[model samples]
Target: MPRIGVYNGFDPVDVCSYCIEVLKVTAMGRASLRAMPLTHLKAYLSAYGLRGPSHAVEKEDYVRAVLDARQSNGCLPRVNEDYYRRHSIPQPTGERPKGFLARMAESFSDFVDSLPQPDLSSHAPPPPPLPPRQTAPRPPPRTTANRPPPSMPPRPQATPGPSNSRPAPQPTQSNPPRQSNPPPPPPSTQRPTPQPLPIDNLLTMKPEELSALSIGVLKAILQHHHVRIPQDALEKRDLVDRVATLVEAARAEKEREARARAAEEEAELEAQRQALEEIERKKKAAAQKDDTGASEGQASQEEIPVAVPKAAAHAAAKLERDGLCVICQDEDANIAIVDCGHLCLCLGCSELVMQSSKECPLCRTRIVTSQRLLRIFKT
Candidate 1:
């Protein structure tokens, strides 16, 4: 069957087919394996009872896996010379074969072989044999006659002094034992100096932490941060206290600044709110004023009293005339004597009339008591 993964339009299939057809196998016989599509290689692997190339990312990996399986298990089918001969079909020789260069090479070789050959035995004589190598005679052994004299003369030994005259042997002196410089003052019990703390950390250090530092370290820190150190701060505790006080003051100042900023922001917000309220109140008042002005204009236009007809005017006049006291018309006749029921006296006139005489004007009856009139009107 045609290669299983062949697809006419797909780029991967096209590429794989191109590789397999155009590329020659490498010396290691892995070019075909590497060129084959991943799917085709994976399919071949299944027949050999090997795992697919699912784990193999690169072409080399696939090639390696295939090579390992093929060599080790010999599971993949192979075609030998006999297999090819058995399967090969003979084609009819209609015209001459296509290999013109092979035909030409064969003809040239036959022509060369058919030509006369040169005989070297009769043409040239053999070269003369080389003479036997002569060995040189040996030289005589080195003797005293051949030896040369020394370059310098040897010196003579000094004569020994008389045995009694020899100087007495000097006494052998013994060296006194060395005093090994007292064991280096027992390495004074000094601890390693600590590295200086960072300025930021020093600024934030607590009282206890400050107390742990040496007075010199504390002073150095204060100098680095440009803090004014008190002259009396000689002791370690005093330095620690000074540092602590500075830290607290800095923290408090920071907090105060933050609070002040927050208060300023709040004040700004409150002012904005009040301004908005004032704007709204002004809008409402202006609206109400507009409404009031409209109402006043309408009132000015419509509030004129309608002229009364003569009859209504006469009736109103008669009513008013009747309401006044007959004695003195200055005040309204709001009081009436009870027994007589005469409505003629004003409140002031009623008192005077009661004091003068307990009598009604029209009936002339004695007035037992008086009551004020309250008029009622229904629209």
Candidate 2:
């Protein structure tokens, strides 16, 4: 029996059937056979029972066999070239199809045609028939059957002579006694007077004493006296100083108006004092700057000397505490060799050195015995 190869889990027969039915590949065409790899060519030929004399088949033989098989099967469907050329029309390039728009327009027209139309005839009732024309009734004929007589003229009466007769006087009644009105109340004896508030000595008052007063009272006093305090001066000391200065200035101006020569002398002295104070303040500020620069330089120089030994000692102690074994230098030293008394090897390095040689790595002294040191826990 010939060895049959399977393609895509389907036996040779199924693969060929699927390719012909689904892929529409003719058995005679080498195009479909060439679609797969060359290794699958033998399988393709075996699928259609197109085996050669030998078990092994060449690609050309397999292709020829496929072609012969397709030809023996039947004729292929004919291509209608003239029919396509006559009926088929090519759409303009880049233009969208008008079929969808035409369909939508048709549907919209159908919907409009299906809508209910209003009945104009039945919308309004016909106007009522005009009422028959009628003429007004003629008035009755006039007659003078009940005519009233004309009114008679009034009769005249003769005038009577005047008589000398007077009416008698009515008896007079006595009048009631009249009461007098009471006298008006006497005028108020005394007028109430407003007492003046006591003024405190602002110049002598301390900041603590000024702060004890309510802010509203202090503001009222300042406003009443017409003393201008700085809007930003919300602190008690600032308000007290401003009030005192205003009062003193007002008093001084009054005195100055009274004594002009004395006022000039005082003004000159005040100006000189202010000038001296400004000069002293500048001098003190310069001295403070120089002192601060000198102190900063001295501190920096002093810190350097004190810091050097502390850093050096700290580094040395750290090295002694956790330094690696001198032998291997890869691990901490936990073993001290006897006779040499040098703790220079880790547990691993000590074991290795002991087995290889009995000599200390640091001193080169003969190591008769090795001692493994227990790790000491420091409090």
Candidate 3:
């Protein structure tokens, strides 16, 4: 069996030398190897007998391993060209038969080349010269013969001197006798006034009659009666109803407010009168007490010293001590529960309360967090 090369130019030496040169150029920064895709780089590494991590090998590390392998081995490992040719079919060795048309064409070309010998030295003649072309003469330009010259302007005539023959018409009666202002221009023809539409007539008027009236005139009438019409009330009947309802409601509200203000004023006056009467009654009681004191002057002086009770002082002291935390009853209540702002617990108890219930103990308001009081003495 005859052997055939599967790859025609399978030069292992040239391939290894080219890969070595590429790696050297890449390492010198003359070319970039990092830009190559991962799959291509892995294939390149495997072909060169350089092993890399199976998974999660970084691009830079894989490229470095390839360079290192090239340095140690001096070149990329060669692939077996003979192994590639093992499965290739053998090429045929016998000569190919020529077609009939091809053989005929070859024979005709050979015969033509042998017979071609034309003698043009005695038979050839020089070419004749061409005749010169003729052209027509151009026509002459037109002339303007009879155009007239521009005419000169006429000179001004001298004004005629006022002749003494006429007497100047006697000054026209000296300013035409003043004319008496032309009798006041005959008084303009007056426009007849439009009659005002009464409210009662408006209520009974038909829609067609209302539509005939101008919108401006209707608006003016409504304004005179202190009525407010809605801007969107464009139709004639809508305008009438809107104005009437607004005016009636306004009048009723005004009356109601006036009555309420009057009642309030009356009540205030009555309270003031009662207060004055009470003041008079207190004055009368003090006068009676003074008369009794005059009858017992010595006992009245002694009673004045004992009027303030001792229990009131004890109650005020107890209230002052309540500012301490109710839970510990030792530290001053300084932490305020959030959302509720209750300062009934100290900082320590507030944390415990947040962990346990996350709510204000007094108001049961959900406690999102708490804040410390800078001034615990403040109410």
lDDT of 1 by residue, 166-248 (tens): 45545444555566886656657776554556645765766677788876677765543334566776667877775676566
User: Clash number for every model?
Assistant: 0, 0, 0
Worst 10 residues of 2 by lDDT: 370-379
CA lDDT, every model vs. true structure: 0.54, 0.51, 0.53
Cα deviation at 367, candidate 1, in Å, is 99
RMSD of each: 44.5, 41.0, 31.8
Over 4 Å off, model 2: 1-213, 258-379
Task: After the best TM-score superposition of candidate 1, give how far the Cα of residue 329 lies from its true spot, in angstroms.
Answer: 85
Tens-digit lDDT track of model 3 for 1-379: 1123664332333333324433443344213667665555564454344577666457887667666654332444334223222322123347453332333345557878999699885755544444444444568986688767857976644754465232333322222233465555677898664454665566555656666676666766554343445678868777656445534444454465466556556656655666776678667757876777664654464355333234444433443455567778755565665465677776567667767987777788876543322213232
What are the TM-scores, per candidate, against the unseen true structure? Answer: 0.24, 0.15, 0.22
Which candidate comes out best when scored by TM-score?
1
